[model samples]
Target: MSETRPAPLAGLKVIEISAFVAAPLGAMTLAQLGADVIRIDPIGGNIDANRWPISDDGTSIYWASLNKGKRSVTLDLKSEEGQKIATDLIAEAGTLVTNLPARGWLSYENLSQHREDLVMLRLNGSHDGKPAVDYTINAASGFPIITGDDERPVNNAIPAWDVAAGLYISNGIIAAELERRSSGKGQEITLALSDVMLATVGNLGYIAEVQATGKTRGPLGNGLYGAYGQSFATSDGREIMVAVISNKHWRGLGKA
Candidate 1:
């Protein structure tokens, strides 16, 4: 095992009103750093307790992994008493992380009334009002076009976009916390899945440069765009990734 580092959020208090992978991972990250996190679930329960890969007794190991080291409470947020409890909890909480639909539910307006300084993170599927998922998001961001062979485009097999957004949200939350320390005021941060996907594409600037000139990028099967890179299957059925650093290396490999 690696050496343990000091917990950065030793005295912070957070309340998580979220389910699913993105926001829960963010909340768990904070808790791992020694923050006090209370996970508020619906009275009927937010997580689907009957999903796959259960224990011998039928407990959801997936939920347990994401929810380790946190306190949980069941509440009915639609009820008058439940809303009151949430409001009070927000007033006392140093941070709030949630992924629920923001408009009809507890809007920033309603929550700000309770405590203007409460730090909030609202995660969404789209920047506007359109609902989206990982595949659709990857498609919109130009990742899928250059994903597969020329014959067909393929969506990424992993939920890379969602995981990226979760990490970015966690970092943004801590940045907001630092800003709060200096300014004595908290903030509200919004991260959308669509926006995150777009940002991921932006990291590869060559793609944008090509698109700007009325030309589009394409999938270079088993090779780099203008250079040499290969993703190949070995005789043992294992995958190997190799990239050429220079013309010399390319020529040497070609000869070999």
Candidate 2:
């Protein structure tokens, strides 16, 4: 018989008060890694409960997909009793993940007061205090302009910024946990959707070209930017994305 090994975060607990993508996704990732994630939704449910990709019975498949493996609790956040319950949960868990606007009861100052070693990860729309979502951030980040084709600009069907920001938030939480082990204190981590998009585009050098040379990159259809790679249709009309960034890859493609 084989013995079972314990998960890395077997004893860890996470209290998540989040909606939509960033924070929820981050909490889900933590849950997957064996943390006991308790997702707190309002009495009517969070905004994502009825989001798109619903089932035939009107169930939100999208919500179910992201929230799997986590325990859920519904509360009336507006009520004083509900607020107290939430505070008690946070104090007990000592770790919180949320993307809602920082205010009132859920604020880090308020929660950390009760538990000095509380770790809070907060996600925001924009760094400049302006509200922004994944779509708006993608539009302003210069990705749409260089995405589709020369005829028109098209936004990505996938919420790339949301996913990236969520992963970043998960990474931040892990880092904070590591720090807390040594420092014997918790830290507040903040992330903005717009900042994540901007940083990603800048890292990819798309923003650097426009800033350094005033040369804006245009749409290149399915081809990779600054690389010899593109999608090609086969004889049977099946499309395949091919990357020939090096001479070896070019030769390999020719041979195939």
The TM-scores of all predictions, comma-separated, are 0.84, 0.95
Candidate 1 local lDDT, 1-256, one digit each (tens): 9998868998888888887677888888889888888989898678654455679998888788878999998889988899789778877886888888765446777787788887889898898856777778887777677876785887788878877887877888889889998998988898988888777777867557877887777876677776778898999999998889898997888897
Which candidate gets the maximum lDDT versus the true structure? Answer: 2
What is the alpha-carbon lDDT for the whole of candidate 2? 0.89
Residue by residue across 38-118, what tens digits does model 2's lDDT show? Answer: 999999888779998999999999999899899989999899999999999999999999988768998899899989999
| Cα error of candidate 2 at position 211, Å | 2.7
Question: What's the lDDT for all of these models?
Answer: 0.81, 0.89
With a 3 Å backbone cut-off (N, CA, C), the pairs that clash in candidate 1 are: none
